[model samples]
Target chain A: MIDRTGLMVILSSPSGAGKSTLARRLMEWDAGLRFSVSATTRAPRPGEVDGVDYHFTSRAGFEQMVADGQMLEHAEVFGNLYGSPRGPVEQAMLAGRDTLFDVDWQGGQQIRASALGRHVVSIFVLPPSLPELERRLRGRGQDSDAVIAGRMEKSRSEISHWAEYDYVLVNDDLDETEARMRAILTAERLRRDRQSGLGGFVRALMAEEA
Target chain B: MIDRTGLMVILSSPSGAGKSTLARRLMEWDAGLRFSVSATTRAPRPGEVDGVDYHFTSRAGFEQMVADGQMLEHAEVFGNLYGSPRGPVEQAMLAGRDTLFDVDWQGGQQIRASALGRHVVSIFVLPPSLPELERRLRGRGQDSDAVIAGRMEKSRSEISHWAEYDYVLVNDDLDETEARMRAILTAERLRRDRQSGLGGFVRALMAEEA
Candidate 1:
């Protein structure tokens, strides 16, 4: 029998590097993968589902999870608490489901710290260049000039952490980028160290031979 | 335009891990990849082509290439000198052609020591178990009992170096094994550090928007 070990893929990138776009595309391609819905204190938008989009909780509830070690990683972002719940992710992984996280560098670090022994593979998406990153930000047209400037400034700091990732992909072309990200996840899933059932599978093959 | 960077993939496995089978399948699936023919001191076998099958070189010539830093990595195996030449590999990579190397753990180490940086991704394949490995060797019907025993013994040492590889695959099922190997190659190709042309491409998109 094949070993069905779970994989955790954390995708991080600057705002316009298309991390979210790639993440959505990956979910479409791989049915075994499920998005890790974050728990946040912020109120959900009109169209967002409470459990599906995010686990919306109040400050008290969020604090309780943190205290009980139910939150894998929690952070106060923009004065609202945002976190990943340990319960659902652990449950999914135990049942052999790969989880995908669209998180920032800070969140990635937090996840790493909390889930040290878990099969986690982190990838950093980079824009091809500083000029390209700035261009992507400007092209979005939704942000004001000041906001774009702030993002570009933050991008430098974020990109500096590229080396921290297990894999780094530059989002030059969406199709190619998506293909590459999918490949990384696929390769990592087959890693022997991550596949706990491999030993038993080998023993079974040996038994048949004997 | 996509910067077509060539990738060199080195796959090493103990006998019966199905390295050759996997290599053949990969070649059939991807047209862009070509096998790296080694320069050997030994004479060519029946149907081998001089330049195509191997760069069949004399011992002196092979040694010369080694001394001149022309060979990427070389070793004396079973009374014959075998080495991967640097020139053809570099040319192929520059021309956007991927190369595959069927080498052992020693060769893998040599390539890593050279630090080609981003151009090389190495994978090691393992059979599910020692008994399975022995069974596969015996089932091949190509070796004597003594030879099979030697291979099984050697495999223990070979597998001990599994930590050196970027990825490891257990060959339990042929189809899944092939798919997993291909996935690693594809993913490594998309790595941001390796794809220098990505910066230019993304910049061009930004320029267009501007």
Candidate 2:
């Protein structure tokens, strides 16, 4: 029986749908989950560490890795290149680890194309309502009216692709949303098709009959 | 804001995958869920009430309902006609209730064909191992070896159609499995696309901006 297999979970949402919050809560709840740290060309923010927050890489290094197909999926967002590295995620999976990806619908599609196994599950998070989303964005107190308006417009486009996800969650309440997210991770981990040792486990039981 | 919208959920599994157990637990846990009581031609067992356990009907009555397309779907199993009625389920939906169907793959397929909406979610349950399934079947002690063998064969056929489900749960442990099932139900209820008031909710917020 194969003992180790990896799961890649891609979580997509509009800016205020609580994707990041859910991811953080899941990591805290599940010790087996590891975040898929992307290699990015953007400069790290204060207190962000390379290989922790992100794998800070130069443009040439990023392009070389992309050319070598070391990255599972890569994209140019906001003029900066960001990509998921294949080697690390594969290593984690082989060690029976789950990886979480905080990405958009496009990135989720790329991962699905590259990894077509039972190990991948994609989820989309949505706000309870467009009005509530606007309220949440305004409550953040970080963006101007124009910035919030721009984000709202982008949210509509992002939400239009809701049907693309394996599971869709409406973030109406924080605690309840976190609980639902945890349940998906737990269920996905127990999928028989992804559990490598299942065939052997069955064989062992059937041996008694023989 | 639309206050009443109904969702139809189908839970199917190979025998010993705990579909009935999970469905029972979900009904006890969630008040919003209403089990779809199917109409059947078979006479009710001792103490079984019509309309509660089932809507007992004569063969002629069943045939008439089918001819009128009043049944959402119907099938014959063990010389008994069984079908889900369309009117009551739609009424529940209009009154803001979610209906659960403990059905086989065929019934699920028919529901998908008839009700492919944001409110519909289907899940397939799987046993963690074939050996476990065999053990569970044998442990029941009611089936002969021949009957057990027949069930095992049928299970393999059922499992082959796992890909047809939107979500798959491996029933390894009862509590975990029940929790996962509940999570799916809860999450589906909150999906923005399924929730009716979202459009008006958004409009209200946009109006405030003016």
Candidate 3:
């Protein structure tokens, strides 16, 4: 196999577009792929593991990490600070393990503009149709009409940034989208710049007399 | 399904590295893929068909085409003029069909610097090792020792340009290399810039009231 450096795969989409499902499928497909855990100031929900789900941190700790440039990307939502700690991601990349980031457009953009942007391969997922997206949202049977409407509004705004991604996939079928994501990962790993051992291999080949 | 523009896939390798075999396999795998036939001033050998195996032309005709900017890339090899005709390639791309180029490093560089260079995805193929490449070259049984030695020299020169390509594959296993090429093609097709109908598709999705 080819020896390569790790890649940063950013999967961004609105809720109900199957972005999370696709990300999960990718992680299941490649055992070496690592999920980037976000640091959050919000209290953990019942039964949710602290580091497994999110790195639950105090607001002061999160703000300090952000101010110290330890956060790759940070955003304040509903008065709670959420940010991706840069330490683990960098460590994973240096160890040649690809890290997956499930984030919104703002976070995707911020990560792509970060210092390690060149390693990022950003993808945006879109629903097959707006009605299908709304139907999926309603199928949850938990959100009220007002909540669904607000979510739909947010989804529309997020979809507007689809063109900013390096690759865009319409999640018409979960299986097909998952396959496409795998193909993207495979191809990006083969990129010339990512093949770290290729130069030495080629040098040895040249040294050998035919 | 996604509606996308075409791509130019350049496959380059030293002779005896299985580039031609891989290109043929790719064509067999994708019926829609087109192979670029080069125009040459050399006389056709037995069973060689013009416009298929090669576009046989006079030296004056080849120079005229080159001067008129009809040739995408051309070089003089073994006292014969050889060039890739731009017309068919452009037409294939306009029709949304991918075109494959079987050329060496110089030709690859020229095509990469051409006007349609943005559409090119160049790949370099390397043999598993230098001794393997020599073994394959000698296995042909069509050349004497001196001819094989000269070819080995040329192969080394060609392999030196491997870094110039977008992707490099060590052809240790043909099936695996072909699969990697397919993955690269699949992922590249989903690139945001290549999806020509994406803008209209996104507009319709936004227009639909959720």
Candidate 4:
């Protein structure tokens, strides 16, 4: 197998745009893919395992990690500080394993501007239509009208950043969007800069006698 | 179907590296793909169709086209001028059809630096090994030992520029290489800049009422 450095693949979308389903399918498609688990200051719910669900930490601890530059990208969400830890991502990169991030546009921007930006492949997913998105949000049936309205506003704000991504897909059909994501992953893995062993491989080929 | 601007896909490699076979397979896979037939000052050989094989032109005519900015890129080889015509490629782009160019490293570099550089997706193919390359070169059994030696030297010169490509594949197996190329094409088609209709699509999405 060709040895390659890991890619930081960031998938961003509004709440009802099928990004979660696509991300889950991608992980199932490639067992080698590592899902980046964020470090959060919030308390874990029942059955949530540390390091698996998230790296649950105290607010002070989270702030220390951020100040020490251990966070690749961090943001404040609903009074909690959440961030992607750099240590696990760096380890994965050294081991030639790609890490996938499910983030909003703000986190995507932050990661793309980070020091490891060159390895990033950012994709934005769009809902088929605003009406479709509202339908899906309403389909959840757990939220009242006011909560759904607030979510719709948040979704609109997230959708405004579609042009900032490298690739954008309208998730009109889940299977097709999944296939496109697979294609993007496969192609990005073969990029010249990502293949770490190519230099040595080329040297060996050139040394062979005709 | 997603409407997209045309991609100028350039495939370059040393001779006997299976580039021709891969190009052929790609054409067969996508019927909409346009193979760039070059314009040349060389006289047409027996049974060679002028337009289909090459846009056979007089030396003066070729020079005039270059001076008029009609050639996307040009090169002189073996006392003949060869170039990719810009007119057809532009028309293809306007019609949302992709054009594939089978060129050497020099041609690839020129086209990439041209005005349409942003739309270009360049790939370099490498033979598995020098010995394997020599074996394939000899399999044809149509050249003298001196000619084969000269070809090997030329191949080495071509292989030196593999690092300049956006993507490079060591052609150990034809089927796997072809699959990778397809993935690259598919992913490139989804690039935000290539999809011309996306801006309006996003506008319509935002205009939808909650």
Q: Across all candidates, what is each one's fraction of true contacts kept?
A: 0.48, 0.17, 0.87, 0.91
- Tens-place lDDT digits, model 2, residues B1-210: 235387888888888878888898998998888999999999999999999999999999999999998887899999999999988888888888889998888888788888534566888887877878888989899999999989888877777776677777667889977887776766566555576675555455345432
lDDT per residue (tens digit) for residues B153-209 in model 4: 999999999899999998999999999999999999998989999999999889988
**Per-residue error (Å), model 4, residue B33:** 0.9
lDDT of 3 by residue, A39-146 (tens): 999999999899899999999899899989999999999999998999999999888889999989999989999999999999999999999999999999999999
Residues B14-66, candidate 3: write the lDDT tens digits.
99999999999999999999999999999999999998999999999999999
How many residue pairs clash in each candidate at the backbone level?
Answer: 1, 1, 0, 0
Model 3: pairs clashing at backbone N, Cα or C within 3 Å: none
Question: By descending lDDT, how would the candidates be arranged?
Answer: 4, 3, 1, 2
Error of 2 at A73 (Å): 4.8
Q: Write the per-residue lDDT of candidate 1 for residues A77-140, one digit (tens) a residue.
A: 7899999888777777877788999888888888887754367788988786677778788887
Residue pairs clashing in model 4 are none
What C-alpha lDDT does candidate 1 achieve relative to the native structure? 0.81
Q: Candidate 3: lDDT of A171? A: 91
Best by DockQ: 3
lDDT of 2 by residue, A1-210 (tens): 236487899999999878888999899998889999999999999999999999999999999999998988889989999999989888898898889999888888888888543577888887877777888889899999999999998888887777777777667888977887777776566555676675565455334441
| CAPRI-style class, candidate 2 | incorrect
Better of 1 and 2 by TM-score: 1
10 residues in a row with least lDDT, candidate 4 chain B: B1-10
Please list the residue runs of candidate 3 whose C-alpha ends up more than 4 Å from where it truly belongs after superposition: none
